[model samples]
Target: MACLSLDLCVGVLLLIGLRCQSCAGSKVYSSPGASVALPCGTRVHGPCSKISWKYKEKFFFFRDLVESGKVIDMKMGRLRVGADCSLHISDVSFMDGGQYMCYDGATSANTTLQLLNNGADEVFAVVGESVTLLCSDSTSPGVGESLRWSWQKKELITANQGGDVTVSANGKKTEFKINPDSSLAIKAVTAAHSGYYECSLFNDSGLISIRRRILLHTLHETTDLPSAPQQDVNFTLTCSLTCAAACDEDINLTWSHSSGEQQQGGAVVKINNTLISQLLVPKSQASQTSTCVVLREGAEIANHKWPVQGGKEVMYSTCSVCYPRFLTS
Candidate 1:
């Protein structure tokens, strides 16, 4: 332990009887009002029975969280250590943003928790798929507080002072539920659910508005399949969505083949409100699966799988006037 430093290391050494080693910086990200588990003890060689943890923030004092496998100061009952020696925290608020250290008798592991800004303003959903719109805030609603979630000025759900939330029927998309963390979950999403969603709070300080404006784009997919691809036979898959002109910046649709090599890719076509992505799949590797995937922000949000099974050998389409297709890009 560094004796000169007045950090949580000193607090743990004085309060608990364990020595902490050098800090290993690891960054973990989570949204506000969400639960997170921080990993620890990757360098330790022995058993992880006597684990202890400490916390510190940039502008705040260090805090001792766990000692001898027990929580010490989380009076709100939100901190616990999992069986894997990782610290779990629920309903995390912005005030809880800090660095956490997990230590054994000799060595230690450190992790820094970064609270996301809840950039969940716009959430895209697939047609017939369930979509969840998060209502994240810097602080969890306190007791005697109430929250009202609205869509385009229409009431969807409300949680009274007692924390019992009541979801009301709003429009055609009726199925909805508020998760324990105050996020609203809607089932079987459609184009009708595309609009602004707002989460409002009613407290002693009057109506405190925590507004979340969201735009949901529902992707519609269709594929021509169940016909196994032979050597030269070809089929195309299409995925389309309707949105504003600028909405395609973060969304992508593509078809993937089982083998590393691709046979052909069709040109993406946009007609007014609809954007379509089609792929010409060739029978390269039979007994494998091909997929049509949708990506947003470089992350796959939806996919449709088509298993390619070769039935029998077939010859390529050959005509004296026909020419081989080529990629332009």
Candidate 2:
């Protein structure tokens, strides 16, 4: 039993030694101005051994910094190595993004030093116009793996230019056709369509990176409608607010007839953000009503009245008169 216990202890030590030998510490820096550090460490089995650091394929520093405390060459001048073999480089540049190596004579380790540019390409398109979203890395397009484009309505995914969609991401060249040109071609442009759209790229290493965002805006024309019903012939009154996109919610439409009759309906039945209110009076109940009120969003925006029979053909007009004192009171 004692021999078995001794063997178990040896096995545990071996496992720990393997992990320590393979462990590599890594740190990242940003491009256009940042710095990073790479730690070189061992299990401390014996006395501390020599340490070395390398950037890309060139050696930047050695154990000399621990004893001499002096800068080396141009790139190495910016680096500092501690007694424990940790490397530090200040004022990092775009070219500094790449592979880094750290060595402790007992065991050597390598780490990736990625200097993210983080500057995304700007993509813009006018409403009803076609636009292409591009993704780029330090390397040019058609040189890497594949690029992807995706659109979302708030948190929900609306369109995908890759996978099921017909987006092609060959090498670094990724392209997607916006059939109708606009994201909201089939659906009208509404406030809901105004959100963040992301374009990304996937490399051979299976890393997904975002490229840019596409901003969408829709322009629309505005009009005023009546707020109160006119005391005219019993006719249906309709009010509509049209835009490039569908409304997020049903429009609230209210109808007010001078005869103390109030009717309400939603815009859902109109297939658009439009309201229709009918105040029917059989030919027997026909009366000389003067006006009809159309209330939208709880505000009397417009009013319409039956045309006074003056000539052979009736002419309609919009009256800008104020609401009666009795109604306000």
**By TM-score, who's the top model here?**
1
TM per prediction: 0.44, 0.27
The CA lDDT at 193 in model 2 is: 34
Residue-wise C-alpha lDDT for candidate 2, range 201-225, written one tens digit per residue? 4444332334444443222112222
Instruction: Give lDDT tens digits, candidate 1, residues 1-329.
Output: 55545574465563453544556556666667656677664567544468888887443346678987778977499988776677878887888777787877677777888776863454455556665666654567657566667765677644554343443434342556676777677666555555556665545433333435455555666556536545676655576765523446676666666563443446667776566887755555445655655566877555545554554322111111111110000
Runs of candidate 2 with Cα error greater than 4 angstroms are 1-59, 62-131, 136-144, 152-190, 214-221, 225-329
**Candidate 1: global Cα-lDDT?**
0.59
Clash totals for all candidate models: 0, 26
Look at candidate 2 and tell me the lDDT of residue 105: 52
Count of backbone collisions in candidate 1? 0
In angstroms, how far off is 292's CA in candidate 1? 3.3
lDDT of 2 at 34: 39
Model 1 TM-score is 0.44
- List the global CA lDDT of all models: 0.59, 0.39
